[model samples]
Target: MYTPGWQIVFLDDPPRLKPAARLPRRPFQYQRWEKNIFSRGKTHTPVRRTVNICPMHTLSTISSRKSTQPFVHALAWFVYASVIYSANYLANPAIKLGDTVLFLVPYILTFYVSLHLLQVFSRLGTIWTIGGVALFMVASTTAGHAYLFVILPKFGVYVFNPAHPEQFAKDALLGFLLYFSYALLYFFADRNIRRRIAVTDLRHQGLKRELENAKLRELALRTKQENMLQEQAFLRAEINPNFLHNTLNILHAQAQRYSEELATNIGKLSKMMRYSIQTTEEQPGRVTVTRELENLQLLLDIHGLHCKDPKLVLMYIDGKPDGLMVPPLSMITMVENAMKYGDLTDPENPVLISLIMRTNELHFRCRNKVMRRTEIASSTQRGLANLKRRLDISFKDRYTLCNRKDGHFYNVEMIIYN
Candidate 1:
């Protein structure tokens, strides 16, 4: 029968038909071919059978796909063995190639076998693994010496005969020493590398901890600063309302008198209030000395409208008030204190205010006859204390404030350095 897709032919038969022509009979043993052939007479032709094998399924292909670590390790050991054998051959001209190969084969086999055995034994326990490795090293060293001296001579590769006990003992000692030395060197080197890695890791961890601590400290400082600002705002809120209430009562008293002076003092009060509110809103709350002096002049004008003796409330400025800044209302606080507590009616001992500039320093002094009333004295002390706290916060160590009472005069002085 004809196969559907494949062309098959018998080598023993020759036919007169064309190569492309199909045959009706099936041969017992046939070869497959893409093209058919024809012959005119009987002829013998060799039958060729073709088998297709996938390249990926071949042994060489499969092995090539596996990891190369084992092969590389074996190659490295082989190179090491070759080097040692070559060195030995160079030292003694009598050592032959066969003898070198004979020594290397057993030495390499014993070393690798002992190493594998130790690795397996290591899984049992640390103590047992150590003891097993030591035992294996001794046994392998002894066996290597025996194979080199006793067995190799029987094959005529080694010149030393096994009958000589002294030579065998000396060679065995040398082999043991070499093996022990190599084992110790490997152990120490591995341990040293591990220790260095551990120390580096510890230092890295310490640095990370220090960085975290620094971030925590920074966060804490920011939180404390926020709290301080909020408290200052609360204190300012309390002080302003009480001050405005008292000033409005005074304005009401002046309005009842129906005087033109009340209207002018009202304008001065509005300007002072606007300056105070704007200055409070500013961060660090500072104004130029010129602006501060203008506000002070307005405040004194309003107070002068009500003073029993306006001439006794005196102020003196001894320097050019340009390009100099101070904490807002700092100088005015001292003036306000003097007017509230001093005997300004006394012509001989008037409320004296002075602002002087010396080089990079600004000196402010206020002196007045101290009121004998306990209530006014207590309020004056409280106001001065508040001013001192504000000065400490603003200028820190760059400014100085002094308060003294000499007999009848209460003196307040402050100096700020630029």
Candidate 2:
């Protein structure tokens, strides 16, 4: 009637904390830089702080890096382009402002279209931007003075003389060349600026992901620590009940027969109790396999005096690396339970328990021979249940417990990772 360790394993699996516990409550800080600038005996201390407020825009922060700076860059470019075009046109009356506007209109249109295309088609942004510039060049060259000539006269401006065929062909080619060259410079500068922004965004995302993973590992460790404290408190309560039952059983035996062996068993039981409860000398979770075996031996000695002869076999395999550690009293409890319930006096029905530790993993095997198919009653579930909670806090998913039945033998096994 050995209680499977797996039954207790699930009992103490710590419930997950609330969503609030997982969420970060502290305010996120922005990285800042300080600059000291002086002008005419006046000192200006500028603290440049970059905060990612808008989550969506934060991803595109590369593109918006200049957002905090002057917002009139586009307007400034337009003014500069207009002034240059106007100056060239006014230098010679033959080159009218109307003619200049017509020649430069395609270039201006191409720059805006390229920038807008980059903003929309972020993946193919650069390709579309180049394509827009190419389209502008081709369109303006194909239409030539045919389109601009009609539009200029309708607006009451004259720059071209269709009657002089030589002037029309020569001026039109010069205008196209000038506009195409300007378009190349503007598009190249704008694309370079946007490309720098996109690269910055990718770096930010990589950094953010690394930070989140670190936080998750820290939180998982903290939650494990809290669970261990709670489980230790619970296990400490069960010690009182176990001591009371053993003492009562000993007293009943003493009353029945005043024997020297019974007194010796009582003394051993007292020593085991003192060792189990002495917290000052024994650091929490500091019990070695040797100490745990001592506790199990004491339990078996007490059981031999009270119950009938209990089957016990102690084995230590060689080649096991030393300095191995285990949770306090973890293995002893399962072995103690098998001695208490199994019919060990019968040579045919014996309880077999083995402990093995190798390469940071602790394995426990407890088997008891069962005779009949009758239900076994056990009121308290604290022993193995406490073991499970302690294991979870200590090892978490790094371990497993299972119950296997082979013929008439019932086996409970626990595998723990250190």
Candidate number of the best lDDT: 1
lDDT of each: 0.68, 0.59
Off by over 4 Å in 2: 1-54, 57-262, 279-281, 306-325, 354-364, 374-402, 414-418
Q: Write the per-residue lDDT of candidate 2 for residues 257-313, one digit (tens) a residue.
A: 777666677667766666656622465554666677777778777776654544344
Per-residue accuracy of model 1 over 192-226 as CA lDDT, tens digit each: 44334434444565598899999999999999999
True-structure RMSD, every candidate: 25.4, 18.3
Measured against the true structure, the TM-scores of the candidates, in listed sequence, are 0.45, 0.42
Off by over 4 Å in 1: 1-259, 282-285, 343-347, 357-361, 373-400, 416-418
Model 1 TM-score on a 0 to 1 scale: 0.45
